[model samples]
Target: MNRLRTLLFSILFYGLSVPIVLSVPVSALFGRAAVVRHAHVWALMHRMLYRRVMGIRVRVEGVVPPGTYFFAAKHQAMFETLELQLLLGGPAMVIKRELSKLPFWGWAAMQYGGIVADREASAGALRSMMREAKALKAEGRSILIYPEGTRVSPGEQPPLQSGFAGLYRALGMPVIPVALDTGIVWPKQGAKRPGVVTIRLGEVIPAGLPREHIEARVHAAINTLDRG
Candidate 1:
């Protein structure tokens, strides 16, 4: 049953994404609004697909906050990104630069105003990300970064990278700690499982909290949810 759902979801997803990918260049030629509107629709479609594919429902806790702020969200599965797209206003995702090279998906990402960061160059990447983040924030776009950097498999929390702290320090804005158990249903890089994915949004951690302290708290919050 899980495999059937996964197959059905994959078919529907690719079928839907192909038209969007093809239209990206046309959208670019026409106007930026085309891309934004299409992307927003895609987000809604993905949300429906997520629910149908995994038989999982997302329950968000607390307000996601209004206006531009850095979203220090935890990464357990790709589902988080889909949810982020729908809920996060003026969304600008911080994604791996490599994903920007993919054919269709890359064009769509670029068109939709996603931020791509090269993970290889330590200093250069950080500076570039911060610069882009600041510009995006200035434009009223909320930034989303997964402190874990990559998907954490079930029952594990990869060592929280200091990049997040560095970003928080540089940005000096309220960091909203998002805790979600995506692996409960999404299962990183595997067949979808049936269950519920709970996303808890904690109050925005005010600026001036030491970087390490903020990182620790974010880690602890996600870990607490993962363990539960």
Candidate 2:
């Protein structure tokens, strides 16, 4: 049954996504606002279909504070990437240089406030990220980043990438660590399990802490749901 649902959802998703992406250029003519809304609708379709067809549900445990913030979230699957854009109202999301270098979708990512950077742990990369982040904040958009930099299996606890700590301190942005249990359902190359995915918005940690302390705090906070 789960496999059937996953197959059905995949079919419907590709059917919807291809045309939606193709329409983005037309959306661009109206302005950035239109493009962003176009992106939102794309995210919405994901949520709608995931719930109705896949029987997967999402539940939040805390209120997301108002105003612009740097949201550091767990990377369990592709689910949170788009869903958070809907939950956070189109924050500028961090993407790797590889993903940003993709074809049309890559160009569209920028229009919707993508901050592209290399995953390298170097001074130059950190400086580049801060530059992109400051520009996004100026646009009145929050920044959403997966500090570990990639998806991990549920219960796997990994140290954050160096870029997160450097970017947080240099940018001086407060952090809102988010924890979610999406991987239990979304993990592996198989059908997605039907279950509730819990997202917890942890207490805000202000900037200026030493890198070790900040990293420790965020590492623990974003893994609140990790059974390991």
Candidate 3:
């Protein structure tokens, strides 16, 4: 049964992931680039398991923009969190502060160039996030954020989280909105279905737009694949 397959896949995937996550410290010893490169391997491993075990395939459409740009994607399942990073050639992520402090995974993510955002939105936290974002950009890396803050079911579309707009204004990178129907295949709390999860990149929205304008544009763009 599919439940048996999902259970087996989860066991294999997470159990196997420990070694690579543990190896992050060794990579970090080499430097940031080393750590980022090491992360690619981890992401690849997860993708392979998703395909080989769960029969899930990711189909990405539309050209990834040429240079530095902020990417906002609809959060439907856990798939896109790391998949998009791999798809974008390891761009820095904007993760929540708590997640950025986990253990080896958190440490590795930070070393791999993630900006840790504080959900409470203190002035200091925002400033820290801005500094990290600028550092990533300075290194020619873009940022990938799930603007709705948390994953929603496939048919639901939540408004963009405030942090996304703030970061967009701070970084001023052109936005590339990505839409994915990941929940159809990987639900929040249910059996995993085997199917193609589509990630579509919508038209670019230029930087420096008014907050209201950019927010609306992003809200519409990242939900393009949602039938609702």
By lDDT, the best candidate is 2
Residues 1-228 of candidate 3 have per-residue lDDT tens digits of: 779879988998889889988888888889888988888887888898899989988888998867988988898877888788788778898888899889767887888998998988888988898899988999989888888887799788777778888889999899999999998889889799789999999898999999999999999988888964
Candidate 1 residue runs with Cα over 4 Å from true position: 29-34
Candidate 1: residue pairs that collide: none
RMSD of each: 2.0, 1.3, 1.2
Clashing pairs in 2: none
Model 2: per-residue Cα lDDT over 1-228, one tens digit each: 998999999999889998888888998999877888999999999999999999989998888777778899999888898898888778888898898888888988888888877866577877877898898888787899999988899888888998888778767888999999898888757789799989899998997999999999999999989964
Candidate 1 local lDDT, 24-141, one digit each (tens): 7777776655677777777788888878675778887878756567777778777788777776664778888889889778867877777767767489888987887777667667
**What TM-score goes with each of the models?**
0.90, 0.95, 0.96
RMSD of 2: 1.3
How does candidate 1 score on lDDT? 0.77
* Model 3 / residue 176 / CA error / Å: 0.4
Off by over 4 Å in 2: none
Q: Cα deviation in Å at residue 5, candidate 3?
A: 1.2
User: Pick by TM-score: which candidate is best?
Assistant: 3
User: Residue 146 deviation, candidate 3, in Å?
Assistant: 0.8
